[model samples]
Target: MRAVVVRSFGGPEAVEVVDAEVPEPAARQVRIRVAAAALNPVDAGVRAGVFGGAGKQIGLGWDVAGVVDATGVATAWSPGDEVVALDYGMVKPLGSHAEYVVVDADAVAKAPATADAVHAATLPLNALTAAQALDLLELAPGRSLLVTGAAGGVGGYAVQLAAHRGVEVTGLARQDDAELVRALGARHVTEAAPGSVDAVLDAAVLGEPALAWVRDGGTYVGVIPQAAPAPVRGIRTTAVEVSPDGARLAELAALADEGVLTLRVAETYALDDAAKAHARLAEGGVRGRLVLVP
Candidate 1:
């Protein structure tokens, strides 16, 4: 097998493709022959020695779409099952950047029948982040929610999901992304955050700067862990840490199949060109996330 690994944590140059032994599934785990994986800013952070560098050479991938090559005794999946997974609640030496990855059976769900490997790979991490953030708000159908960085991956999903739940959505994005965000179901799109909303989902990592956008006594959901602003005037603030849930992913995949969710891929790179992919992501203005084909 072959995988992209960070030989030494630093810049994109540190990422290298190397031969690796094929991994096997453990009890309650499934081994996937990865077809595609999504690249996130977190991958760059991890590559730059952030998040403790995984303490050694570490593979960089979390969102994957592939075919099941093998499964564990307790796993419900079968060989040849097409799946999309978030590799978050599992222990492993390498991530989905490899040709094969082993993940907990409970962390993967059937991929959208309407999507290919690349599109499906883009769903798990960002979609789960949006879904979990909305879950924290617990907002009722006629309420309003604001999504910062609304054109980005997580924010884009947040707007669509909130709208689908009948919540009025307002998205903060670049002036150029107004139409795109509006198409995703946001009722309003602006470069600046509104004065107040029933709740705010800070997908942009606006952190303390975004607190003013929420109404007093309302909820503020953030993506950046431990970086959300302090609650003020009865406002309740929480940061979301997305967890792998095959059931939730199944629901999301249904939405995608139903055309309620749309995914965009900014670029696709070969496995060996992982460094170039990271460099492009860092350059910014990427319409959506980059994908890696294994």
Candidate 2:
């Protein structure tokens, strides 16, 4: 198998695409012939040494979407069932930047038929983050919810899901993305200005500016765990680190199948150009999730 080998932590240039051995399934694991994977900020950030890589020396993608080619245990799946799954939490996690990946069968689910391989690949990490963030908010109808970085993958999904629940949704993004954010169900959209709200679900890495939008005693959730929140301002803030829940992921897929959600692809690159893929993410302003076709 050909894989992008990361020998050290630094930048995109560290991702070296080279010949590697194909991975096989272990007990309770399924080997996926990877068709696609998504480029997430976490992937690029980890490669850039912005976030701790957890001693990773292999590859750097967290999302995976592919077909099951083999399984260690006899289960409901056959040799060719399209699926989307996250490999980040595996004990000896295999990176998704390869032609084959062996992930625990319990960590994956069938990909929504409504989504093609590239789009299905976008769901695992980002969408799951959105689901977890919203779940933490315990969103209430008629309550105002502000989604920072609303045009990005996690934020975009949060806007729509929160709005679908009839919460008064607001989004923070650039002026260009205001309409796109609005389309995601934000009742109001802005490029980020000083304001207060009932609760702020900040997917945006809005540093000190975060203090402006969250009201006293309001709840706050952050995607970036970098800066500390000013809880002294009477705001309850916590970092929403998403975890892989197969059942919740299955629900997200079902929502996609029912047309309650949509996938956004900023671009798709071939598997071999994994370094270039991470480089593109570094240049910034990724309007949507980036997908890699393996």
Candidate 3:
């Protein structure tokens, strides 16, 4: 099997597409014949020496959509079941960028018939993160919510989910990408130069710009780990690290099937072009998720 691996952490060029042994399922785990994998910002962070020795020479990717080829224990999944999953955690390795990847069965959900592998591949990481951030905020319907970097994958989903829950969403993004955010149902789209809002969902990954967004008593959620926003006095600051929940993925799949949510695919690359994908993501301004057809 072929997968991208980093020999040294520095740049996208450090990633190498190498032939490797295909893994088998472990206890309560399953092997997926991956149809596609999506890139997350964390993948770029891990590749650029962001964590120094801890993340060097690692396989970095979390979003995957595929079919079950083998399973260790039967809960609700079996061989050949179409699925999507978040396969990594604080200590777990990322392996979804490969031809076949093993994941804990408890972390995956069946992909809806309404969505193909590409949609499934794009949903796990970003959508899950948005869900958790919203959860942490303890927000409710009719509340005023504001999101920065609202044109990207997670931001797009964040807008829709908040809107679905009946919250009024205001999005901050590029003038060009504002329509994309609005299409996801953001009530207001502003090119406000990344400053000031009611409740802040900071997808820009920058701290200060996001800090300026909220009132003294608002909720602010930052998606990047280690890039914690300052403790704005009188405000609730939440740092969201996405986790794999089989049940939550099922819920997201249901939304997609109902035509209530949409997955935006900005582009697709072959497995070997992982480097270019990384570069594109790092450059910013992409409107949707980028996937690798493996």
Winner by lDDT: 1
Give the number of the best model, judged by TM-score.
1
TM-score against truth, every candidate: 0.97, 0.92, 0.93
As for candidate 1, its clashing pairs are: none
Per-residue CA lDDT of model 1 for 11-115, tens digit only, reads 888889999999889999999999999999888877887677455777789999999999989888999999999997322359999899999999999999999
Candidate 1: regions farther than 4 A off: 89-92, 191-194
lDDT, candidates in the order shown: 0.90, 0.80, 0.81
Clash count, predicted structure 3: 2
Per-residue lDDT of candidate 3, residues 166-192 (tens digit): 888888788887778898889889733
lDDT of 3 at 82: 90
Off by over 4 Å in 3: 54-56, 90-94, 191-198
Backbone clash total, candidate 2: 1
**Candidate 2 lDDT, 196-247, residue by residue in tens:** 5777888887755676776777778887654547674777777777776677
Residue 45 lDDT (model 1): 79
TM-score of 2: 0.92
